[model samples]
Target: MAGVAGRLARRWSWSAFRSPVQVTCSQAFPLHVSGTAMMATQADFENAMSQVKLLKKDPGNEVKLKLYALYKQATEGPCNVPKPGVFDFVNKAKWDAWSGLGNVSKETARQNYVDLVSSLRSSESTSQVKPGAESQQGTYETLVVTSDDGITKIVLNRPAKKNAITTKMYHEIILALQAASKDDSALTVLTGNGDYYCSGNDLTNFTDIPPGGVEQKAKDSAVLLRDFVNCFIDFPKPLIAVVNGPAVGISVTLLGLFDIVYATDKATFHTPFTHLGQSPEGCSSYTFPKIMGSAKAAEMLIFGKKITAGEACAQGLVTQVFPDSTFQKEVWTRLKAFSKLPPNALKISKEIIRKNEKEKLHATNAEECQVLQSRWLSDECMNAVMGFLSKKAKL
Candidate 1:
């Protein structure tokens, strides 16, 4: 709480202090304009777009409309498309903006737009928009908290090691979630870096946990692990996951709790609990059987099967699977649109969906924690883990 307030206050306060370039592209009768080929080329259009992106502030909606009209006129020659309906103010404005340019040559429209950007650029000084105008304010050392346009993205940052979640990272992620829940943000996106979403708990930290009897189990950080997973169960805002790559261990299981799951075609989700002599941790013990049926959940937990992105989607674990190349951009654009909805409505809707299961989810988490802690010190668990680590070392 208090932490969330302080961090977000500093994070969002600077968004207003910016200098945005002004754009002018209004016409009452677009189709009536004179058609002439100006000297402006494709290079000019590219430069203007780049400059517009570099402005300290986001371009206004009107400017965006002009940019679209100019782009269409420049590339396609003219608006052959029919005007939108009178009720559709948005498309109507856009139609008049372009078709009204009626006979104007594509190059002429391009030249005027390019000249507009140049003039705006000349008026604003470099000092007005300094490099790194956005401070690394809410940014964490092991977690990336990127918040803009009412959505926050928490990217797991340990990409070099498949974005493995370390103890420190778990704590940082917990804090990030807490902050996002209390903040005005309408949605939060969770994903990992590099070629994997998250490899789950970093095994390096498990080296010291003695492998054997019930007496030695208490020393392991299983309780902390349980608490960390609980964070996902209680998240307030809409939580979405982008499974960018391989998701191992608890990472795959947590997908059951996300409001939406978007995965890349290259992604593989594996819950190798049986292979590791462990049990489900993230309430998958309850969620999986319900979401994917008892038979499928048994196959995943007992057999440790590797579920492909497509398989996960078919099993109802993933909301959608996108091509690896376009995964981020496609998911991000949709999330931004989702973020613009009525915030309270979204929250209440989510609450209603999870309403019945919320308490049982917590109870199951506690039950699963007890079983996992006991399993941690069992003889079978030790042999399995050591063998897995040994093979990993050989690789």
Candidate 2:
């Protein structure tokens, strides 16, 4: 455990460094009004509303409040209704957000709303386009999403980084899952573009510290991680993982959430959360034990053990292993047949199977993320991350 004084000192030192672009309670209103000539039109407001409907992940309570306030102000001039009583926290908060907008004109409110949505969308497009990526017309930077013949395949596209997941990739995957959930496809598949299935969370995601400090970054990341995992827990369609090669960290841990996970004979599974001075996530703490038994789960999650394809199959983490020579051909052949099954039947059957554990899985996800949020700010995690980076630099 870290000394209390040291922790206190670090928090105090970091607290004053405010994120320049962040909007807080005191700075909420008067949101960066720009040229009135270019103010968003009524059509823009409607477009923004439609875009909000398509958002996959919840943008959090604060942002929701802002959106609600902007919409009410833009459409209805100002808040005229009586504010709810003090004990009615939910309504009271909404009233405060709207009433706080004061006498802002409808045009200005619309513009601000448009700007907010644009900013939100901008954040998700931060991933750099890597070389050799065969990006489709309407695909995510870190993933290639395609639906055909009843299967929606989401392939991790950054093979140059061994398919390591970045922050943007996490958000993109959530978006892809959301799209697949509503598509005509009977099932959704997750795989990788190149040799490795997924190397795990891109370590560089930890190195960039915004002015919000480690605490704020940890909190934001925890929220993203929670929503990312929740996508799998709630996915209605059959979710299959085509583990073409190795998988690690979150990629390996999340396999438990899939209905089926097929791997190449050369593929390996690993979770090195402990090595990074972090705790288990992706609901591995709960599902790992349930799927593979306590001792084996402890070995992989608690002790950071790496297991081979055959071993993972034996432990029940993977459904089956195929030869590298024909892994894709074999997996696709089986998946195509599975996908051809009645979509509604497959969906309902999955719901029935997952119903008993849905609540538990959600609870586990919340608890694990909460623990990780704390761990991400600790000195131990920071030091371990730095050590990992230093070695990578040498390489």
Candidate 3:
């Protein structure tokens, strides 16, 4: 929410948000465009932001997110929040863009951002940015999104850790999901890169959490979780999930919200909420019972039961399942077929189905955050998480 917080706090100044770029640097600076006029002053640094904002050309999402980060850096200086998860390519990129300016004075970031945009504007051969340089806009360090035709696939790439969801990764997924909703050219498919879909929240995220008292930390963490979960709940397009393997924690609970779920024979789902001595985060407390019935939901959430794909399907939690070896191929074909269906039809149908649940989901989200704040602060959870970490280190 650091990047988001900056975005939401906008004063939307006209000079920055709406201005004409025709005004040359000569007005605010001592010298030339390509020459010694390259020297710029503080006023010019501020003016450059306005000039860049007035560019006639569309710089695309990558450049846009970069500019946003740079503008924030120039105005706000170093990042004050935790780096977002690697899965959230947008915020991660923005964080990197802003974070890289660390040690750079706010005045300097403004000047450098001016220089960067000036160089970009002068390029005529192609509008496309240089490879790797565009990565400044964001990096998918733990996730990847690839598209063929109109079907886009977002993969959780941290297979070595069973695709564990880290703090940064959560932000990336939310950003990607938000992008998917607005992407008319692509319908999204989410799944894992290897053996497991996701193994739940990364323990290291706890370590990386902003330093604060237990209550403050819980508030921050709960707020982050609420935003992430809400992104999934309010997404404005058809969302499909391909469960290639086992999943745990919010990853398992999230399945209740997908429009359709296709799983592999090896796919299983688990939520270790009670086992971890914590409460649920994905609003599964409400969604799970509604989707799979109260009794089955209790068996899974309360007992932390491991649910096999076949069992999940029988309980109506899974839409379909395919052989493990051919899971990707089968799901790909099915999604492509789904892509062939009228996209607007799919969109409208999904909206209609989800419309009724929106308020309840948001209400549940608020309640869950309050409860989670308490759970996270409690001694039971503190001991449980530490015990797990201790054993993981074989200490």
Candidates ranked by lDDT: 2, 1, 3
Task: State the RMSD for candidate 1.
Answer: 22.5
Expressed as tens digits, the lDDT of each residue in 1-395 for candidate 3 is 66653543353332443343212111011111111222347677666666676566644434454456556765666779898997665457557755654564555445445654664454322224453321222457778876566776788989999999987788778656655665664478888988898888888766665556666777778767866776777676678888888988888888877888899999888888887789876778998898889999999989989989999999988999899888889888877877888888887888788776765675577677778778888889888888888899995
Candidate 1 runs further than 4 Å off: 1-139, 209-220
- The top-ranked prediction according to lDDT is 2
Candidate scoring better on TM-score of 2 and 3: 2
Q: What is the alpha-carbon lDDT for the whole of candidate 3?
A: 0.69
For each candidate, give its TM-score against the true structure: 0.64, 0.68, 0.66
Ranking by TM-score: 2, 3, 1
Q: Is candidate 1 or candidate 2 better by lDDT?
A: 2
Alpha-carbon deviation at 298 in model 3, angstroms:
0.7
lDDT accuracy of residue 46 in candidate 1: 73
Number of clashing pairs per prediction, in order: 7, 0, 11
Cα displacement (angstroms), candidate 2, residue 257, comes to 0.3
User: Candidate 1's error at 288, in angstroms?
Assistant: 0.6
- Which run of 10 residues does model 3 get worst, by summed lDDT? 24-33
Error of 2 at 134 (Å): 16
Residue 121 of model 3, lDDT score = 59
